[model samples]
Target: MKKWKLGMIVAAAALSVVALAGCTAGKSSSGADDKNVTMWVHFSKEDPEGKAMVQNITAFNKENKKGYKATVQYIPRSGSGGGYEDKINAALNSNSLPDVLTLDGPNTAAYADSKIIQPLGKYITKKSDILPSIIDQGTYKGKLYAVGYSESGVGFYYNKKMFKDAGITEAELPTLDKPWTWDQFNAILKKLTEKYQGPAIDMQLSDHSEMAIYSLAPFVWSAGGNITNKAGTKAVGYFDSAATQSAFKEIQDMVKNGYTTISPKQKGFQTGKYAMLMSGSWTIQELDKQYKDISYGILPYPVSPKTKKLVSPTGSWQYAMSASTTKTAASGALIDFLSAKAQMYRTSMANTVLPARKSVSDEMMSKVTEPMRFLIKQNQESGHARPVLVKYPQVSRTFAETVTKATYYKENPDISALMKKQAQEIQQYLK
Candidate 1:
């Protein structure tokens, strides 16, 4: 479960577009107008994680001893009213939203901006212990709107055999402290292209929908460019900046020089056709499960040689409360119970995720293997959350479409003109 495969439609915030689904539920028989604390999530009790959450909720309701028990409604995550965005929209329209709900990190701003959810800054019990990026992902316009129990990350998954065959030594590749510079990375990819029978790198174009923007963001940021201005009001100079253009040129060089392919012989890195894969840490599980003999290494994402700055994509699901809810106290209690250090650790370990809290991540990484440690270090040091703005959907989509269109079928694209067009389109959503 890529868990949060970000294939969302880039709809303007004012347009009311929702992507992804949660679960499905009918009104429980607690009396139609029951005022018990209520919550909604994207998961169901059918799974272990869901079951565990239910147990937690039950214990919390009983332990609080306030007679303010909570009920949860599950919405089908793949359907119209149940999909993440659709369900939230439906709930908003009918004013039937639960007192507490979950949101993806990037979507927190949209909800906060639209006044759909209220700030929960005071409820955060371990602000300093949590990953800085997690807090950043939940903050918008200077307010904390959400909190996440778990987190995910992207990394460079490489084939050890391919690297060895290319005459590349492990010491020469990217390390946590000293990752490959653009020139060094480019030179390696060139050599890797010759050794790799399939594609030099599995950029995973099939993931062009979300991965295109999410995973590729580090490059732009490392070069000191961004998808939007700090205020999130526009994208004029940020997306079209010289730093971004330079990153695009390197991407162009890789393509022009035959370092990648539109159609790789094999779609998977485990198949040994690709030398490197710019993918999520989930690939570790996939590797452990299959292709036992394939030697692989996980590397930190490369930085811009020009800026020499390091960065990596960071964000995941978060918890938020309804603005209209009268049960702020009860809702806050639920958030605390669900995101407690132990709870966060349980979910992170179960889902193979990096904990959003530094302490929890430290504990879990102590029990996990390989890339988890690497991911933990990187998440602490260089994790950069996407733009947390109401205009993020627009900005993200624009960056994805603009940058992808710039490089997809053509090389040496007029990146400046394309970015300007992107900036113009983005300004429409500023209001």
Candidate 2:
């Protein structure tokens, strides 16, 4: 759901620590016997996501006939990977890592490159049944090092009542196959702003978090631009390219034209103050349970006028076997079981997250709301995983900061210069 954060000190010490600790690392501190497997996750046991995980582990422990038992420790991350990541970093130095652990999807490359996590391609029993985007996010160096239980997709959630009030017709709404062009989308926003007499969309521009990259990167992709090259080894040309600049300029234009606000009201879309919101599946549950009075519909992301290619962002937390563990067999088994169809369905239903497996989504088609089914379809068809770089956190942070700086600027920000500077800083990490 969010990007993982790695402390600078931990990153700097990674190579030296791995070299010193070697393969026998954490054997003494893991505390798992041959028959027992220990796992770690980043949410509280009381949270819905946490409860679903506990249920999955409970089911795995009861159903598995391999004479293996599993247990979980909840580290409960606060802000962006907060306490959970801190604990993991500490464990990395002390060799106290668990047998299995959950890491954010973007961290697969970093974790695998550092030998903190192990590849599991041979261990996954239902590899083909998993969604391609989910698999794409977890694979690094041509090896599968992680498996996400739930996937994510960002789209435009529009207020149905507000759209109707703005004189928009049902036929004017865009679909996945024929998404509105950027100009058409801008025209719609203008109409909505005219009717509401205020900002028409909530882009959450004030939040300079991972949400920035996760939600906005698709615009860059749709415009035939990238934050880094295909190999993810450099960003100088890609991040500062003309296509990338145009995409950011489009976002900045929304703020400049008063179509969206940097400081939006809390729950503005749910409260009907904004005509639309750009968010992910998590907002589905919140809108249903807390703002049931509001009528909403999900729309495919508006494509670039030039390319008209539909692309939506995708990534979330995933399960990986810890390299420190000696019990590879049991750890792999636990990861596979938790990511299996049944467990993925249960966790996704409870958490209102997008399913990472095709079978799970098919089973949920009749059970989920129309908007959720729409999101699932969007994810299946157009989802694009973020860059899988060893230094992904640094790149993501710089990208997010660029969005924030551009959005809140008083005048037209130098989009090219802004991206150039950030890309140069990110290049240092790429090397």
Candidate 3:
């Protein structure tokens, strides 16, 4: 999921305009032949995710009846819009895109609108088997353009020992069906703070990157609010609405009341300095392999007291067909093969990512740990895809900035004004 963030090209506007002007739709450049199909990925071959991808490609070449042989070039991203994205941008300008490529979830609309990628709804064989959240993130304007192999989710990673020490029993803990509300979660935080005499949770507040919005947006949605309209064309009213304000204010109050800190210590939960940590699926791997000193469990996202609705975030890198590809049949076959149940399960298990297919998750329940199964269930039931917009990078950055700004209670006491300023900045990107 973190890698997916790098796929959010900073020069999306330029890519859109230049690609629209330069690309020859339904035309093939180099890299694809009658039998050879080429693709680009954002990870090195040595990476576990990349390794799994290679295995899938090998399996596809051996098993597919179409006799399509696919090869991948790994241009690992160095920074936001570097390496793989840099290559994609240059390729878009020069009209040299490969047959298939991997793109982040949020960039689907921009790529589709600029004719960089073609829709894949008709080509997908197992559309019904794939998670709706995965399909939701990959579709643009009612057309499926991409398919995610894995999904992502954010939740509460609590210290089991710390909870017990605070007199909070296991029975008192929340579940997927009966998740804690904002008020209920706050009460637990207060008790933990009193018992520990320090911060109760680490929200990773100082992180000013994609993580800010990736993890925090669920709070707004759970409050029955949104960052933009359904069409994703406007943000002012939606972003600065009362419901959105209430969500941030509750978090702001946490910072002010010492329930959580703006600058959390590294591995605070594992080291027993914090009772809970707000993080994503990646942390599960770290906790299991690197930080085994503590007992822990993952909890579903807390809902707003008013709405009592549960929502968690979901997005990841996905496979899409380049519009420039003349090998549409072979390319679509490769995509379906990569996103199918067997490959999805393999990559998800090998990479420790959530599977994009319901069947994959169900199969995983028999093999994966309880916490992993819980995350899979929450992702399937409550996952909310991020907004699909052409100017997603700019809009996402502004929304993240708002999260950081709102927590600075003494510096910015008025939530409405802060949201308004952030909304106005995002509006520039929308226009």
Candidate 4:
């Protein structure tokens, strides 16, 4: 094992857009009569969803009786280079924050903790309409701070054609009704590895630590281990625990025995090299385009023999109002629009991301294809939301570092000692 420093630089290219003047300050409307609201979204303007989003907002404004209008500012994704935090922080400190903004799941808790975002629980009339698990993602300290707009869950994606070639029956494939135990999952991996020349499984563990952590979470959950305490306030002892150590060892064993490949540079599942890849439904469009011959399906993460039940990690994007906004009413209205059925339809069209509402997911499932339907079902029924707390970002980063070190080192790092040290560092920042 070699000690490696994670270094990758990918710049986010800015989109070309005609600037709207009134949208500069987070103000409502232009003249004394018009109400204007600005939303800073985390998507490229060139993206199809970004185009659809503009159309949806325009339509919403036309129908709005509240005289509310919205302007969308596109923010590029800072891929592996990781400058998103600095951009967000600069925006927040300037008090020029957008009236409404979207945030990734892991960062939601940090925003909520800062009290810079208003909770939607007060203004929302349709709180009951949202899924409990989705709602839980945006809640901090029992207070609902944001509204979930889209959800993604981790699962094993298997190619039906490849399975057929390997002579594995559909019954043998992991499913909701018959999930795989760790041993069973490895057996399938072994078979796939033997049948295929390349890696049996594709586990992306390179630059984006979140991807690795997300892929591995189900195993931790299934093993009765977790990255942090249930409240997410303290780092847990699981990273170096016997259960986690065993899980990492198993993964390493798979790599050594030719059952899996650990690569930082491989293209995602869309390439169709590996028999199975740990991925989310977000990859469906790419898969549909790139691997037309392969019939793919998803299943919950395999259960550990000790846990006896499956656990999958759930992730989502949330909408929140900036505390700096002078127009709370206008921001609330915009948030409401985002949560409405109409906007949800726009979201579905733009990104294949599943809607946060249970009814929306139910309606969308019937209309979508096979694996997506299964993915949504698994997310709704069996998935577990990441624990929400103020220190989530820091904790997640440290957890990723710990996991990577443990997996690469092949020896369990001192979990208790590392956690205690990290806990102290976090407590200082938290206080």
Each candidate: RMSD: 10.0, 8.8, 9.2, 10.0
Tens-place lDDT per residue, model 2, 253-372, is: 899899999899998999988999998888988999999999999999999999999999899899999888888888888998999999999999998889999999999989999999
How far does residue 319 in candidate 4 sit from its true spot (Å)? 1.1
* Residue 13 Cα positional deviation in candidate 2, in Å, after optimal superposition: 31
Candidate 2 vs candidate 3: the TM-score winner is 3
What TM-score would you give candidate 4 relative to the actual structure?
0.83
TM-score of candidate 3 on Cα atoms, chains taken together: 0.92
Q: Residue 324 deviation, candidate 1, in Å? A: 1.8
Residue-level lDDT for 103 in candidate 4: 82
| lDDT tens digits by residue: candidate 4, 1-431 | 12232221111112212233323333332235337887877777788768777777888788878888888888876765345455567666545676788887777777877777867777665788777777888887787888877777767787777878988898787778778888888888888878876677777655446666666766766787665566654443544466665565565566666666556236545556777777777777777887677677776677887776777778777788877677778778888877877687678657887777777886796688887888778887777777675766665676566556544534544544544554455444342
lDDT, candidate 3, at 71: 87
Could you tell me how far off, in angstroms, the CA of residue 220 lies in candidate 2 after the best superposition?
0.3
Candidate 4 weakest ten by summed lDDT: 7-16
lDDT, candidates in the order shown: 0.76, 0.89, 0.89, 0.70
- Superposed model 3: Cα runs more than 4 Å off: 1-32, 79-81
Error of 2 at 236 (Å): 1.2
- Scored against the true structure, residue 61 in model 2 reaches a CA lDDT of 91
Clashes of each: 12, 0, 0, 3
| Runs off by more than 4 Å, candidate 2 | 1-32, 408-413
Best candidate according to TM-score:
3
TM per model? 0.87, 0.91, 0.92, 0.83
